[model samples]
Target: MNSNFDDFVKQNVELLDQHIDELFDSDSTLNTDLKMMMKYSIDAGGKRVRPLVLLAILKAFGKTPNYDILTVAAALEAVHTYSLIHDDLPAMDNDDLRRGRPTSHKKFGEAEAILAGDALLTVAFQWISSTNLKDRIKSELVLSLASDAGASGMIAGQLLDIQGNQRHYSLAELKHLHHLKTGKMLLFPAEAALIMKPSKLQVAELVKDFMANFGLAFQIHDDIIDVTESTAILGKTAGKDVDLNKNTYVNLLGLSGAKEELNQVLQKCEQDLTSLGELQPEMDLMILEGFLTYLK
Candidate 1:
């Protein structure tokens, strides 16, 4: 929410873009079409929120990255972008646009889009493997990434989400679903950061809570935006959930109720950050505040 946090995120985006270009080379040994598709989707505008938050949290803990943070961040962005590519497929959300342009499948054809996503997913681990951190730390990050982005996490949440269409979900059920589908990837930053720089147990717990609540708040904001924003403003199809008859916080809780829940989560997120008092807390708290504020 703060100007400082905004600057931090903006700077991180620049870093992420640079790293992606280097890591996902357009002139590599891969087929030209596949490379073009991959580059197109990756360069498609995204917030790079995951890596920024991860870097912020690590800085909060009075630690610098164990390796080139931008490269590591790019790895996560690859995963996130890959998810978007798959999500926009005709078999998935059937989206026609993303980041203000044609969806990968729409731009490159479905088969090429699919391969592009696959390449990005594989490249995520490849980037991680290429990192200079210790083997244990590298393994921890890779394993956490797999767990968060894989079947037991985002994939499972997506399955639950698809099945949840046409069915009513209690607030608890909705939270659980988003926790997996959206929260895990969002939480990955703080989780991976904690592993990189082992903070005190209490700090670790607070960080988990903060990231979890932030993740939920972020998703709720998205649900609200889908209902309230125009497709042009969203740079992606808006109200696709409604079109698909999918369950969402806005539908279940009503817009006001959803906003209320978001505030509660945000208050808790702020409180968690508050507990980390002093000891170079200003920058970290500012980043978190900016992260949350930017959501609105």
Candidate 2:
């Protein structure tokens, strides 16, 4: 990754950490154990990809990062963290580690981890609504987040993923599954940023197209990493996908094929970004481009 992205990521992550930490402090009604588990997972290391992507998209459109942006970013991260906590449960992917630490369930007991996930998911909306942004903007963000993280989105993807163990899915079917499971959250950043800047609504579809390809490329990269990286490097159990018999790009397409597909998807991302640049010359796409390059 480029130095610019590295610096942006470091700065934003610290800011987000502060914002998320403050959320619990202001709430007098949070249970101690529940708060501990939530903080455990939230403070547990993650790349904060969703928040970074959302902030990056807003930056591309000339919106400076501020407390309000941090609030929205924190909300996005909350939902993502909740998903990770739940996804690692015994009933789900049954992971034992995440981001190089004991999985939430492993560290906090199954019931506590479950409640922690529940708390994070529910409070994410509260964070959004509590933001100082206009009500319309806040509502739009909440709606986008809900639809993306809800039953028809990531949940559907998870359901399909579990069921995929029973049968081989066509490539198209796999894409559809991931488009919900992974793509929608990635897509939400772009959509949310566009919502914030109605002036750039004309390129909404173009931006969504870019994020769609980016999201798939991300998942493909993850599949490749699962096979190539070690448990230590991945910060999670390596080859778990294979152990779980989950459907993945690497399984459906050979390693070389998956790499080839990743390249193709990234190339599409570049094309989409270029089209956006053509429409809005002032938009800084270097950070966005760096994201694609980093995935490669």
How many residue pairs of model 1 clash at the backbone?
A: 2
**Per-candidate TM-score against the hidden true structure:** 0.94, 0.97
Per-residue lDDT over 34-105 for candidate 2, one digit per residue giving the tens place of the 0 to 100 score? 888898899888888888988899898889888888888888888989999998999988899999999998
TM-score of 1: 0.94
Residue 32 lDDT in candidate 1: 72
* Range of the 10 consecutive residues with the lowest summed lDDT in candidate 2: 195-204
TM-score of candidate 2 versus the correct structure, residues matched by position? 0.97
Off by over 4 Å in 2: none
